[model samples]
Target: MHTLFSSNILSPPPAPATQQNPFELLFNSAATSNSTASASNSSAHSSPIEYNLLTRRLQDERRATEDARHVEPTAVRRKGHPKLLLMGQRRSGKSSIQNVILQKMPPTETLYLESTNTVKTVSMQSFAQFEMTEVPSQLSIESPEIAYSEANFRELGTVIWVIDVQDDYLSSINSLVHTAGFLAENYPRVHFEVFIHKTDGLSEEYRYDAFREVRQRVQDELSDVGFGHREVAFHQTSIFDHSIYEAISKVVQRLLPQLPALEALLNRLCSTCGMQKAYLFDTASKIYIATDASPTFLKDYEVCSDYVDVIVDIKALYGWQQPAKKPAGGSDADDEGIGESVVTFERNGDTYIYAREITEHLSLICLMGKGSGIDKRVLIDYNVSLLQDAVVEVFKV
Candidate 1:
């Protein structure tokens, strides 16, 4: 589950969720192998077809999870949520990335987030998906336990190394070469994607030059360390804009096996509603989990993202950003208020934007044509209902 600005778990998580965060949540509606094995022991006795279904469902659920905290690696590499280690020195914007994606912390709030002072594995309560750890600079990389653990070499999918381009560079480069190059030689399968972080403050020329010069230096260091074989993808990332979220979304989409099915459903919704496009966005981060197959132009994505920002801003102002101030002896429904909205406006032309509640943390955003007649409104509402039903069915799995 995606957490809100200042919280982690719900009021009370369900069952085992309190003790150990289960990885599978609405984000990962499907189940994972480790979870399934742990869920029902009797499942193992099922037939081949049944087992196949179970495995696929587990994998799907793993992908659906919004964010998972890191767990200590055991001697053996157990099947679990794929690991994503935020590797960088102090003040490299590592926590910003984690808070932005995991806690859904506002970019501004991240400025005040406390610096991680120790090595700790953070996991969600409702489910434990893949593990994530904010690897601070002070970590002892030379520790034999961590270096010898098979899980360290086999489980990680990506190491998001951050480079604070505006900061002192010589020390960061040396650390990058020693740490990343050693892993490249052993963990050839692990991907290396670097972020030239905090580039929003740089001019275009500086941004390009910084990106290029830093990337080349890292590459040269890797080559010197005999890790030049594999390519390292680089990005200019900033928590202020949608750049980091978009980059993380691309990294995560590769892990979602249910993505095609979700996209197909969105495509069907678009056709049925006669809308231009549809997106299932992770509400906190404002990143679209899935979108219709219609080719996405930069302008279209920007428009949808901006509309989502408006919805969030309104919700923050008057909606459920905070718990309702209930009357004494309040009824259960009293706590439930209107968290969804439907509004129409002009942008290039008369446009209709409908925001529907998908989950407590997810929402459906759609782009409708200029028609505002009564009949057109009904059609839009009708299709939205269908879309919700489909989503419910998806969650049932």
Candidate 2:
């Protein structure tokens, strides 16, 4: 006696009309027809089954995604990205360093820069393809919100401590000592660099003395703290001259994991091309990321670095503005137009400075002696082509 509704299914109940009913005879026989109703009920019942299958499929997919996430966790840091931290006491040229080096601001103009009361970071791919973070002078390692926490220190490649030479720097040295000791013990991978800054006002002899004094004090203090084995690099810097650029170039080189490869490639280029020296420069920052294995003379580096500026300046005036083509490889920022320049100038009739574009944001500047294959532009270009391809491979730009 049970009807279809007695089961768990949700199909609608049958209508009450029947063929035996007397009302069926009074109504038109054609109006009683419902021949397709069984097919309709079957299709309607199949919908819920299909929906259940779809729901199960979606759940399986979500679970698989979670498993994959667990198998390969998401990365917290980007590959090939390093951060350079600028830290020191107030008015120690930390902010000025960023302004002069990254913003192309004049050294004199930095005098008017307001004090940074909070941590600030300037991210640039054109500047060595890394981030430069400036820590407020008031913040210390003990500050709860200090940027040098263990988590952040793990991401840092180098920390440049700027000490104003003209000001009383003893307190600065003390702070640097404590900070360095802490970091050296905790973050052994991070490099410690000291910049004897604002030396534009000091005489040559005083500069040397100041540099020695700072080095000695740091070494002695670190040794007393039982970290005598720790390595710290010292550089004399002034925004008014090329010293800052040179120091920064060294810092950037240390951060590069492929520096040895780049240097070896440059050595090959220099030897095969009979060039005295070769520099791979970051176009925007005027910082040479790599150079030949040969000893680097400050004068030679200064000349080469200045040549980058000269080429860019001349191009700014006369270089054609063509749509910038995609670079071979690297994270150089996109530009509206490509600025290309090839410059050669003879110095004292002995050294020929040749510079040309290697990539959108990189330049290869070479110093060739007279008769060192400078006149044969075609051969040099071929060798440089190989170098360009190799550079792209090395940086995987």
Candidate 3:
């Protein structure tokens, strides 16, 4: 049998020299692991690495701000966190989107979600830590002092404007246009994201039509206002399916400063390992942090995301728990909380899906085909271990 990835295939081409060259770091890490593999053959495997650099940095910043002044704790926390502002017209499904996606509330349960009367902020504890603030629809954009003063759009990373597709959405589009205008004049750096939400009940044809209509209206209106060049992203989402998750994944990725490096790394990993697709997912939130540059098909993303759900369910159902461990200081705060799962299925008869915990919050899910032969599994694992180490290195403060 022929090997899928020849030794020569692993050598990556020279990338522009950044201060921290990811390719150089990846190869060096892989070499070091290979050097130690034989010596540690009989030794117990060490605990998996935990990636909490972002969280730790935020905590440190919070502490620094607290020591310097006497400000509201909430305001201090908001200063450093990646802020996701959710806005829409009254009765639009903004709260439902947050409740279902971030809070893990069931789709049907969102029906009982009382309308958010005030600005509500929730801290998202994920690989990319952020705060999601939902603005009440009743708050009008015409009054900047009232609405703009409270939300502090200058600090926002993304503004997600939700529009209910099933309702009379013309007014919703108008509100989005006005909001975009306000942001354009004052907080130009904040990214605008529109969610045509609650489309599960619409027919397939209507769903597509509604998506196009909302997008076109927003574009035309924005252009009419002189903010024509402003970039605005649009997505059709529903709490009932994986669309919302996929949309949010794209949004969160925009907030990651290391996105280019992560994408470059995934591209190298896939090319070197003979893998079809690879996603660095924030497992706790089911949002992919990055993926290989290869064209992404909907079916592939759904399968990989669903596999994460399956792993989580199995762990919960089986009550899989790690052995208790305490550090020298007797504190459990430093636990790595690592896990892994792998399954090969016959999608096209030779496909394999592999999920390995990259950190306390991140997991790498890979889709491979015939190249992942039984004999070559060891080689593939070695390459993945290299990816794990390189990823940790990239996130280093």
Candidate 4:
């Protein structure tokens, strides 16, 4: 709730003013003298000199104080979970897979072309007891403006490509491959997961055969693009099948260990902002942190220069007080400026409570040091426990 700006400069107090009456009398006298002198020197000298010696001295001192302040290089060690992106053709069961993984149906529907126009993000606590972000197809493909925003892609850890096994559209395959190519080109270091969704639609015999064929097609396409078949992992999934859920759990277990901290930071922000989804803007980082919370206080949150790793709260902005009210019909709320809270923490810094609420979901983003060099999965598990405790505290208060 508190943000500290570390500045060495101590602005000087204003110069003491002389007694008003006395100062006025002196000014009057000076003016009279100056006028008389000007008349006397009219034929010889020009106007009397107007000097502000005190003002000049004050300005010089202020500049010197600013110059004296040092710019120390401080490292920011952020500790959080990974960002996961889900993508696939229309109605490829991407949302269904997300529901299975998150262990809850999305507040919205999961159908063909249901997300034809926008991208959606779901924040959840996985069975693995780790915080994970599920980016649905709506927000990924339909809304290009939001999808490629700097905030959207910067924290992304893994891109999960879901495919419907029952749909035999070759064009869908091409689109999927192209999407992968685009992502790989943009984010070479990010990991990937290709899910063959809707496995329940096919019979046991056809399911296995289709799964194998889909895997082969993905492998061939990836290989053709020079992305080795081994680089990607494939999964056969059906939201109705418990076994599919178990398989996904295993995949997440293996991948969770490699997730980065920014992902966790984002999930916390989304949950706090009450935004069903958000796209990141890199330029916004210049003024604010890379992540965004919904119900945007303004259109963006800026970074506070006082602290190297601190984001400025929207309330602190020059003009950000009233927030926009939610629209009727339970539609998503529009982001105004930045939200009231600012998320700040340093890597290797002391543990602090960072919590926010989006609608009913409460999340806490914490920073952990390298004291133990703990495994990534282990770190996530620990943070999830901390988040739950923090949420409970929010309700208690």
Candidate 5:
């Protein structure tokens, strides 16, 4: 029996300080006034010092405004939702099975191909209580290379191998088993569900025989690998059958308990936060960050809800100006390199910071002037601490 559980188990982190300080606002207002004065005196022949002072003051005022409006550090948690990866040759009724599981027609038709060219993700909201993400047909068993390379498959919770009993390939269960083996190796923890779909087209006797044969084949393969008979489960399902839905629901119920933490994190992040997207960054590589952009946010930000994390160094990538540094030992002759700015927050007696250049990627709308080189490593380290603090504080785990 599959157990269904709510993914929204984690609580949202504390809201960051939204309001700006009065002094900061006043300084900005004064800077604007100075800019106005400078512009008015532009026609008069102003000395180089006056002109330089005005320009520098204006730049400072702009930087201060940006800093004041900057967004506070926030971390998003990836909730464990029941992700089902469908596998099998093309035209195996895979899409039809997905439609039934989702209780709606598939967003698009499944296609037949020798190999998958790209990986696709579909989020079904019909099961709002439990999130469901479906792997696109392009990366199914028919396209082994694409399936193996797709990053989305790494996070799947279950592999639903859909087979068309009437198709010519139905006689051979080897392909299906091989796909299952691939999934088992890549995602060892994910469960397996073999659905002998298109049973509606088969006679009652033949359907039963096909189902039994496929089930036995899968079991034998599993037993050969030293895994017990209980490792895999088979279901004879058709789009027309209502009981198939029940079977799917039951499977979900059984798997929920094993992934409480992941489910809780996702639920909290999706429900309480104004932003529907969050990212996970790899500290060592300074790359491999993941984000799920809701449909609404996708238009503005070309991000998807799928676990697509792009690797990049925020400072070097964004071209933020480095802050100038004073000599460490008061040696006027020695010039120290500039340092990068990072956001910081404290949680559970631990301080964490996430250092990234303020850019469109992070929704930082302010403009920063170019300056000396800031230490990229320092900024990255601080930002990492900030992220850790946010996660620990918000999730309490």
Candidate 6:
């Protein structure tokens, strides 16, 4: 991997000098996991370390306000987060989505846009385990260093190619298709996902049409290039709606190997609880990490997302209403955070929503049939305890 690095400006961190090094703890596990996967086919395979990223980060604010951030050509200060690169044309809202997801920047801030000129890496650990790097649109992928670096990585990366959904650019589509095809073919281990961005301002019908048009065209091009439809995934993402967060969750979930087990546990919970569906949602972003086996309708996600908002908003209002009970050295899980939440409201007279707190950062939302003849609350409460243990065991891996 050092052969691909001219400088350690954006390289992964080194080993721990002390036992308390958090960076080492975080990235060392990544390196260990990378070594475990052995390719069955004689395809190109390099170390599966997360350093060889193909994703983008938010441009440094100082640079966004002045000039684009400069990629510091210095030695590595610490081991880095797994990397994801943003590769796209001009004004594609790459920096905006990067900022919202990584920096927790408000979506409103992205309205005042500025062009970036250099590659920038930003630290992000709250969501996924990757410190994303954003390459400038002006940076040519034809660069030997980038191509060589990409060719050497072994981990399955997520490439979110941002597309300006509002624009009419045949040339951009041509460029996008060609680059996507080339990368998907060469980097079989990498996931190439297309984001039809900045569609929030459009009408719902128009947005769907726009996404469909772009998706079909991209798929057609990939088919012509001798690739299957499943080779690439397309998402309609925008900062204004929950779609972006949902799309990002899908991208991040691809990187999480523990998700399948979690989903399996969720499926068991759903079946055992006599519920129609169950969702394991991330509290910070309101994005579901896993769910039950039932086909997830858009209505389900939106409804559960709103249900989470209700839980959070109520907690914010009444969190101070209760007296204090503090824990010892560990963090407090109760006071402001939800210990339990239950509400049964009719949606379509016969359908209802049932939500409960699982962990501090995870929640379970179950859609139930009104006439199941079972005590759902009791069953769900009992299963939540088991689900909690399963969640712990899954992440412990």
Indicate which candidate wins on TM-score: 3
Off by over 4 Å in 5: 1-78, 106-118, 126-154, 170-172, 225-230, 258-397
lDDT string for model 3 (1-397, tens) is: 1232223222333222333321111211233333333213211221111112222333333334334334433332224546788888877888888887778899899889888888888876665565788888878655553355645754567889999898898998887899899888976767899998888989998899889988898899999999989989998888888899888889987666556546655766776677899999877778898887788876788999999888877765564354334221111122454466678765565678888888766889999856676567787777777777667755652
Per-model TM against the reference:
0.62, 0.74, 0.75, 0.41, 0.39, 0.68
Across 1-397, the per-residue lDDT of candidate 6 in tens digits comes to 1122213312223221323211221212333334322211101221223212210111121122122112432322223233566778888888888888766688998878687777766654333445566667776555554565543343325667888887764556777777676666666556778888888778988989888988888888778877755467788888887788788778766655455445555655665656677787766567687776577676778888888778777766766645545431111246354466656664464456777666655677777765533354565566676677546534432
> So what's the TM-score on candidate 1?
0.62
Over 135-232, each residue of candidate 5 has an lDDT whose tens digit, in order, gives: 44445453655455545454455767767777765444666666666656665556887777777778978889988877776788766764544467
Report, for all candidates in order, the number of backbone clashes.
Answer: 18, 2, 0, 28, 21, 12
| Ordering by TM-score | 3, 2, 6, 1, 4, 5
- lDDT by residue for model 4 (1-397), tens: 0111112112234323322111011111234334434332231211112112222232343333233332322211112344566777767766666554454453234443244444556564321123344444444432555455655565565777777777775766787777677777776545677777777778889888887887788779878987653467777766664444434443443343211122333344334323333322211111121232233322112122222123323323433433433321111113442122324245733332232222222222222223322334344444444434432322221
Per-residue lDDT of candidate 2, residues 1-397 (tens digit): 1111112211213222222211111111222122122222232223445433433332333334345445655423223356788999999999999988877899999989999998888876663456788999888866766654567775677889999999999999999999898888777667899999999899988889988998899889889998889889999999999999999999988766445546655766776677888899988888888887677888888888888878777655554353344442232324443233445554566567777677777888888866564456667777776677656544541
lDDT of 4: 0.42
Question: What does the lDDT come to for candidate 1?
Answer: 0.61
Pitting candidate 1 against candidate 6, the one with the higher lDDT is: 1
RMSD of each: 10.6, 25.5, 11.6, 23.7, 24.7, 13.5
Candidate 3 off by > 4 Å: 1-79, 141-151, 317-338, 346-349
- Evaluated against the true structure, the overall lDDT of model 2 is 0.69
